[model samples]
Target: MTVPTPQAPRHVRAVAVQPHWSARDFTTPDAFRRWMRAQLEMARPHLRPGGVNLVVLTELNGLPLVLRGGGWALRLRTFERVALALFLARLPRALPVLLRERVSPIRALQLADIDANTELYLRTCRELARESGVYLCCGSAPMPRYARQGTVLRRAPGVLTNQTVLLDPQGNLIGVTDKVHLTPDEEAGGVDLTPGDLNELRVFPTPAGDLGVAISLDAFRADVIGSLAAQGCTVLLQPDANGAPWTSQEGLPPDPARVRDQPVAWLESSWQVTAQRQIPYAVNPMVVGNLLDLTFDGQSAITGPAEQAPSLRSYVLTDPRPGFLALAPWVTEGTPDELRQAGLDRAAHSGHPLENEYREDTLHADLTLPPATRPAPPRTPHEDALDALLRGEARAPRPGTWRAALPALPLLALPLLALALLRRRP
Candidate 1:
């Protein structure tokens, strides 16, 4: 027996947004909702009334909403210090959850305010999707897995995971996917995230196509990307937040022969994987600017398989360039030579004054993917092993398998080396 292939509509207007990520003092939930609404309003020009429109926001863009009630600390220099302060300020409330759950202070801090933060996050997404009449891929956040438990939105009793949510025009959650691969800092540093189950990757049925999501690091994994494509996902949405200088070189370089810029390293996970897998369309929206000390910098872009004809014309980078459907304008907009001559490149990488080399922009492309020319390959045993590993049912992987290769892959390195020692504020 065979299953029918999932089909996409002939045309879709995809919008990828590059949002400036700065800490806002959200003293009230309405303040938080208004800020989110303003970000989506930037894409209002791209939305067509009766057409298939989908807007994608960057990963962890929703994370700062956790700062809802953060007063003067919102103006501080680093998130680690602010988070520590918040945890300590609310310790009396957080201690109970911490002791009950046997989790870290950071986890308990989140759990303490999970109900309010989760509600604001979901409500903002629902309202925007319903009002704009567009499918919305709300940016990722560190929150517990939530489900509707007979009229109440309840969270699962587990450590928080980074999750991306999809909402339809009617304000219904069409799909939800968690980050399967986490950055080093997320695993060991203060974040203390739980890696998501590989088998739970969801594919959403939209007018645009059967959409699949690979949150930031997960986009780089063959097992994750291949699994989604095999399940008939034609459009790949990668919500990302690269908390490092976009111009700086870090991690295992994309090319072993020589060092390349950060964006080049990103290509391996974005268009490179989609092109190789024959996935028709891919959209990556990245957050930029600084949230306290942690910074995010990247040019949000949308592209198709390299073999396919270019459907969108704008390009962000000229060096190590790939065909892009739509690319957002950069904060320091120009070629490497132009930037160097202007001395903006040095300013971008400087450690002195806080850098403002980030932009807020929305990119749109009217894409019509060519019909699939070949069948998507089936899921492999290695992928099955990944699923089992997430389920705690797999034996230790042998030499030269996925486990062996993990250490070398570029995992969207988030450099948090500058975190200051946590000191209590008098």
Candidate 2:
């Protein structure tokens, strides 16, 4: 076995894939193969001889093998959770499993799928990496923490975890970054994912430069991105999945203006990290016509460095629909440890950052969708309550404050009563 050596950062092309989705994509195992094949074909041309291919979040959830119909309310989010609880309620051979696992039935079934097909995704990624000759960031999916068995990766049963696996050109597993944040939809029944240690960020050696990987909300976090850049990463790959909300425009509402345009949090988050860190950040989000009740739609893009205040102004490769590869036009030119030695990390404290000076002013990619009004993301119950309270649609004061006001209300009224008595006497 030969030890891989670091190469000087050269100009390279990177593609972010926006996967195509449909009910078939998640309905059966066979559909998964078909959908994934299409995705590979779209990404093949952009893989280039040496570069990166980023597949966005929950790529495997597309295999909704168990839950089918009912969009957000009926199937994907709520009812499926209830279904999980019911399925586990009467299982005869699950006492030991219960001790080690607390994931939903949906999550459990997905894990089972992985166990039955050990090393399937990993092997596929290895093949893709070797064939494409570019580093591949195989975004997230549900599985137990992996342990290799011979040439296969065997996952222990009931060990719940999901990760972003990185593959080199030779099909080697160089890094694994697990997800960092969970929306309320994921933790509905008081269950959540095992968060990866932010400190354990893997920096893969490549001619393209030292690359770091972040999953979903991990890219949004200031500390996380800065720490990776501080660790000397020239580029960051973030695979995200925050679905498009249910914005029903049927039978148009009397006040269409009430429907606010919702900007994607992860997209906006990508802009902040790229411009601030002065590094190329590739982000890919999952998109679908509609899943059961969930509607997933968004673009995939590479948000790289720029010189002006609008740092990512023209340096963005955005693919909003019909899955395509988002690529950068020019290769980044830099030395070994170019990003680390730049001392741009110190700029977080000072007002100046060194990396922003190098800009890719020329546009490189052609795959794109014109900008449109993004619907507001669906709010969690907590968010809904907060919004209602703020808008005076609900009155839910704290128990302590309400209780405190009870006695005070009567006491305050006594002054009014006394004043009325005095005025009558006068």
Among these predicted structures, which one has the highest lDDT?
1
TM for candidate 1 is: 0.78
In model 1, pairs of residues that clash are 78-293
The lDDT, on a scale of 0 to 1, for candidate 2 is 0.45
CA lDDT of each candidate? 0.68, 0.45
Model 1 ranges off by over 4 Å: 1-9, 25-27, 147-154, 253-259, 307-322, 333-354, 369-426
Superposition error at 268 for model 1 (Å): 0.5
Candidate 1 lDDT, 42-87, residue by residue in tens: 8888887688898998887666765778766765556667787677
True lDDT of residue 251, candidate 2? 29
On residues 1-426, what C-alpha lDDT tens digit does candidate 2 reach at each position? 999665433555556666545554544445555665565566666544433333333343423433322123233233334344323432222222332354443444344344433234555556666666666666666545544333333334455544676666676555565565554444423223455566665555555446676666667676677777676666666665544431212121586555432232334466656656544544444433344334443334566544312332222122232212243231232442442333232212223543222222111132111122223223333333322332334443211112422443445553453333222210
Q: Estimate each model's TM-score.
A: 0.78, 0.58
> Cα deviation in Å at residue 18, candidate 2?
1.1
